[model samples]
Target chain A: MIQRSQLDLRKFVAPEFICGHGALQLAGRYARNFGMRHVLLVTDPGVRAAGWTDAVGESLTEAGISFTIFDAISVNPRSRQVMSGTEVYRAEECNGIVAVGGGSPMDCAKGIGIASSNMRDILAFEGVDRVPVPAPPLICIPTTAGSSADVSQFAIITDDVRKRKIAIISKTLVPDISLLDPEPLTTMSPELTVDTGMDALSHAIEAYVSNASSPMTDVHALEAIRLISSALPAAVREPHNLDLRFSTLLGSLHAGLAFSNASLGAVHAMAHSLGAACDLAHGRCNAMLLEHVIAANYEAAPDRYDQVGAILGAAEGGRGTPAENVAAFRRSLGVTETLAAVGVREDAIRTLARQAYADPCMVTNPRRLTCEDLERIYAYAL
Target chain B: MHMHSDPPDDRDALREKIIGLGETSLHKSYYPELQSRLAELERFRALLDQTHDAIFLIRADTGRLADVNASAVTYLGLSKEELLAMPFASLIAPHQKAAFLETVRKSNEVPSGSRRTCTAYLVSREGREIPMEITVRSVIFGDEQYIVAIARDITDRILTEEELKIKESALESSTNGILIADLTGAIMYANPGFASIFGYEQDGVFMGKNLEAFFATPSVGEEITGHLLDNHTIVKETIGLRSDGSSFHIQVSGSVVQNDAGEPLCIMLIVMDITERILTDQMKRKTYEQLGKNIEQFAIIGDHIRNPLQVIVGYVEMIDDPLAEKILEQSCRINEFVTQLDRGWVESANVRQFLRKHGDGGEPPLQTFIHIGATKEEDP
Candidate 1:
C-alpha cells in the first residue's frame, strides 16, 4: 500500500539544445556561432560505409564550413588512434568537430578535441575530470541505438601505456549538440541491435540503483527501462522496425540523460577496465557482469533495486523480498546464466576482483566491498 | 628718647648677628660653585672634541675668529690654525658665503632658540669644495648672542642616490615588458616596453585594470588568478588579446611584489611576446603537413611510373640479338630517368654507397630510401 505523493523533482536541462531527426543538419550553423571555419568530422569505418559520414559532410558543406574527414577511428579507440586523429585535426586546421557514429567515434572525437586544444598526451587524461580546457564546438550524431554517448557527458578512451580504459567525464567535454537519427540504426545487424539494446537497459537499471539516484533521474531511468525491455527484442528481431527503433533510440537517450546526472555504479567501473584489458565489447562485458553487480548492490539499497525490478517487470506488484526481486529481474533480462557462457574465466576472477575494487566508480557504490567480497561476487557470477 | 635709643641698639645688635651668618653661608657656597663650573667647562670641551660631528662657534660682533671643534678640521679639510685665523664667511665657498652670512645674522638677531640648516659648499685647506650640511643654532653666551654651527658631509649618500636613479631609469627603458601593480591589482607603474607590447602608448597609463584584462579566455584568467593567489608567482604561456580584438601569444612571468616589511604590496608582470614563435611554429606545422602531402603524391607518381618502367625493363631483358640492343639502350635510359627522380626525392648515403660498390642485395631491406637518380656528381 504505497501512497502516491506529489514529489518535487529537479531537472537539469541543457542551456541550449541542438536536437531533432536529422539534427546533424545544424552542424555548420553551430560551428559558425563558435566562429569556426574549418571543421573535423571524426567517424569509424563502419559509419563511413553506412553514409553517415557523407550526411554530416553535406550538412557542413551547406553551412559553408570546410572540413576534413578522419575515418581512422577504431572501436574501443586506442591511444595511438586518438593521437593520429589529433594530428589530423591539427593538420587540417580544424576549429570545430562533428562526431558521427556510435560511442567509439564520439569517444575518439572527445579525446581528439581535448588533446588538440589542451596539448596533453592522451595517456595522461584517464579516469576522471583531468581535461581543463573547453573543447571546440562539437556535434555528436549517434548512429547506434545502444551507446548513449550522444547525450551523455562522458567519454571512454583507451590508455595504450597502461593497457586500460581511461574514462574522461567532464561537462567541458560534453558535445554542444547531439544529433539523433534513428534511420542509420536501421542498418545494424541483429547482434549489434541486441547488444546495444541491452547496453541501454544496463544504463537505465544501473542509474535506478545508483547511490546518487534522484527523483529526476529516476523518471528517465524508469522510462528507459520500460522502453528497452519492450522494444529491444523487437529491434533485434526486425532491424528496420521503425517504431521499435525509435523506442530503443529514445530509451538510450533517456538512459544517457539519467545516468549522466545521477552517475553510475560498480558495474561500469569493472566493465570499463575489463573491456580495455581484454579487448571485449563494452556492451557484452556489461551484459555478462550485470547480474552479479546488481545482486551486490541489492544488499546496499534493496528498496532501490526493488524499484528497478518493478520497472523491469521483475517485482510482483512492486513489492517483494530483495533476493526474490533481483532473481526475478535477472530472469526477466535473460542474464540468469553463468558468466562462463560469456567466455569469462574463473581463473581471472581474482584479478578482476582487485580491479573492480580499485575502479573510480566504486567510490559511489552504496555498500563498499572488500577485496575478498569482490572475489566472492566474481566467483558467484562465474 | 635716651631710653628708647638704648632699646634700638639691641635691635641693631640682632641685625648684625643675622648679617654675619648670611655672609658665612655665601662664603661656603662660592668656592664649590666656581670649582664645579671649571670642571664642567673642561668636560664639555673634551666631549665636543671626541664627537664625530663638526661643531663651530661664531662670534656675533665680528662674525669672524670663530672657534671650531677638532672634527671640523677633518670635516672641512682645514688646519686648526687656518680655521681659527679665517673669518667664518671666508671659509664658506664664495657661492654659499652670502647665504651663510644672512643665516648667521638672522640667528644673532633672534638669539633665543633660533635655528637653521642648509646644504652648502665649505672651502677646504687646498681650496677644494666639499658639500656639507651646515646647521646654525643661536645661543646667549655671556650676554651676547653666539651661533653654533654643526656641519656634516653627505657626498657618499648623494652618490648612492645617483646610482639608484640610473639603475631605475635603465629598468624603465628595458625591452622586456615589466609592470607593477598594488595588491588589489591596481597598476602602480608600467614600463614603456610593457605598454608597447600590447600596442599601447608608453604613457598610456593603466591604474585600476585587473590582471584578467590581459587574457581572452576565462579559463586562463581563472588559472592565472588562482596560481597568483596561492604561489605568489606563475610562469605560463597564454594568448593575450589586444585592445583591438586581435590576439597574440605571450610567456608571462608574474610575481608578488613585497614592501619593506615583507608584506605583499603589488604584483609584477614580466611579459615576453611569443606571438612570433607561435606563428613560426604554426608555419612549420603547415610546412610539415604540406611536405607529407607532397610525399604522398610523389610516392603515387613513383608507383605509377615505376610499374611501366619495370614492364619495359622486363620486355627488354626478354629480347635477344639486334632488337635487344635497341631495347637495352632504351631500358637503360628509362632506368637512368627513374634513378634521377629517386635521387631528387630521396638521399640514402649508405644505400647509395652500397649500390655503387656492390650490386643489389638479395633481400629487400625493411627500410628503403629509394633514390630515383644517380649521384649528383655522376649526373650530366
Candidate 2:
C-alpha cells in the first residue's frame, strides 16, 4: 500500500461478481434479465468436451433463451476466429453473449461483442481505451481459475499476419456479470492447473510492485499472492477438492481486480511477446518469465517487492533472494524448463525484447527496461 | 505496497482509463439502456398510428387481434377493447372470412418476409361492409408468431369505375352515326349507327380506316378536318360513299373534342342519311318549274281572248245594235277573269319561294355544336 505522505491519486474498477458452488447456474436468469433472448455461446473445444458448455446451454434453455454454439476457438484466439464468431453472432441474430470456458473463449467473446456492435475489424482496437461504443451485454461463466479474463477489462487477440498479440483495454470491456464456480475447474489437467496457478501468482506479484500500485490495488494483490501460493499445490494434488479450487478461483479474481487497475509490468509484456512469437501457452510463458523480470525490476521498488515476497510462500524450505524463491516455487510446480527447452531460439531474443519494449504494459512497469536489458534477461533465463 | 510510489505524469485518456478515471468507466448496468429502448418503441408506435391505412397485428396461432393502430378504430367504428377481444377473421366480410383465415395459415408456413395480398370487405360496427385491399405478412417477435395486415379503403375507386361503364354504354347505344376520329382523320371508334349507315357489318372492322373512306371525295374528309381544326365546328351536306362504293347525300355535323386544356384531342362527327330528303327536294324543284311555265302560258291565253273580244265589242258598238251592247258586256266579263288569272300566277311564285325556304317539319337540320362551317345545299 502507498504511504499516506506519498499518496496522490488512484481509482479501482471491478465488475459485479459472485463466487460459490452452483454459481454458474445463475447465467440464464441474469441473461434473461439483461433482455438477451438470443445468445451466442462462446467456448473452446476442450471446454465443450468437458461438458461445461452443455451445462450452460441447459441453463439458458430453462430460462427460455435461445442460443447458438460458437466453439471455433484455439488456446490463443486469432483475429480471424473472432471475426468468424462475430459472423455467427450476426447470422443467428443474437442480442447478447455468454462465454463458458477459460481465458481464450472469454477474450474471444469480448472481441466478438465489440466487433459486431461497432461493425469494424477486431484489430482496429489495439491500444488502451480505444473502444468508443460499449459492447452488448456479456455474461461470463469462467471454467478455469486463472487468466482472470472474466473480471478484467482486457481482451488479448492474436494478429495472424503480424504474429503478435494486441491487447484491447477499455473499462467497457468488463463483463456485466461473472459466475465463478469451482466445479468447472475440476476438469482441468494437473499441468494446466499449475501453469494457471503460476500465472495468478505472477499477476499478484507484478501488480504489487508496479509503479501504478495504490492502496486499493495493493490490498488485493498481496492477498492474492498469499492465497495462490498456499492453495495451488493442494488443488493440483486433489483435483476434486472444492475448497482448494475455490481458494485459487478467489485468488485469481483478486489478482484480476489488482492488475486490471494497477496495470501489469515487464513480466506480462515479455510473456505476451514470447507467446506471440513462439505460439506457446500464455500461462506457461508468464510462469517462466516471472522470476527473471522480478529480479531485473527488484531494485526499483524493493520495499513493495519485499511485501509480495514475504506473503508469497516458497516450496521445499526455499530461502534466498525473492527472485530465487519465486523460481524455486515455479520449479516445485513442475514447470522445470528454460526458454530453449520450450523452443525459444537464442537469435530471436533481440526481436522478442524489442516487441516487449513496445508493449503498453511497460508504461506501468516499476523499472524502465531497454530492449538490450530485456534481451539479457531472456538469455539469463535460458 | 503504496510506499515509495513514483509520481504520475503525462496523463492521457488511455492512462486515465487504465486507472479507471475516464468518463465512461462504470459497471455494465442496463436500466438506462432499457429506458431508451422503450422510448424508441413508443416513438415508432406513434408513427404507425398516424398513417391513413388501418393496421392490425394478429397472433398467428390463435388468430386473435394482438394489437391495432388508431386508424383501425376509426375505420371499423369499434372501441379498442372490443377489437382486441375478437378474432381477426371475424372482422372480414362473412363470405371472405373463411378464405382469409386459410391465407393466414399459409402465410405462417412460408418465409417470414413474403407477403400475401387479397381483396376483401371489412365489416364495420354498423354492419356495413367496406371494400379493402389487404396485405398480410407473418413475423416473429420473441417466441411468438404474429401476422401484420394493412388495409386501404377503395370505395372511391369502385364508384368511379361504375360511372365510366355507364358513359361507355350510352356512347354504344346512340342512334345517330357517332364516329369519333383522331386528328389525322383516322377512325378511332364508329358506333353501330355509323356502321349500319355505311353498309358495313357491326364487327368493328372499319375501326382503323380513315374518315376519308366514307366520303365520296377523299378531299372532303380533309377539308372537314381542317375546318374543325381552324374553326372547331363544321356542318354541311356532302356526298357519302358506302362500303359497296355507292354514293348518297349525307349531312355531317362535326366538332373537335378538346381536353380540359382546350387542345384538340379528336373529332366527333354526327352523321345523318339525308338521301331521301335530297331526292324529294329535287322532285319539288322540277314541279315548281313546270307550274311556272303553265301559269305564264295561261296568263298569255287569257290576254289573247280579252284582246279579241274587246275588238269585236268595238265593231258592234259602231253599228249601234242590241247585240253590240251584249258583246261589250261579255268582253268586260272576260277582262275580269284574265285579271284574276294574273293575280293567281303571282301567288303561285310566292308559294314556291316559301316551300324552298322551309324543309318538311321533321329531322331538323343537323348542326355541329359550334356551327362555324356551312356550304351550299345542292340537288345531289
Lowest lDDT block of 10, candidate 1 chain A: A1-10
Q: What lDDT tens digits, residue by residue, belong to model 2 across residues A64-100?
A: 9999999999988999999999999999988899999
Shift of residue A89 alpha carbon in model 1, Å: 0.9
- In terms of lDDT, the poorest run of 10 residues in model 2 chain B is B370-379
In candidate 2, which residue ranges exceed 4 Å CA deviation? A1-6, A314-316, B1-28, B35-380
What is the CAPRI rating of model 1's predicted complex? incorrect
> B240-337 in candidate 1: lDDT tens per residue?
87767778899989887677997877677788898887776666556444554565566668667767877887887877767877876887787677
Q: After superposition, how far is residue B370 of candidate 2 from its true place, in Å?
A: 37
- On a 0 to 100 scale, what is the lDDT of residue B192 in model 1? 81
CAPRI quality of model 2: incorrect
lDDT of 2: 0.86
DockQ of 1: 0.00
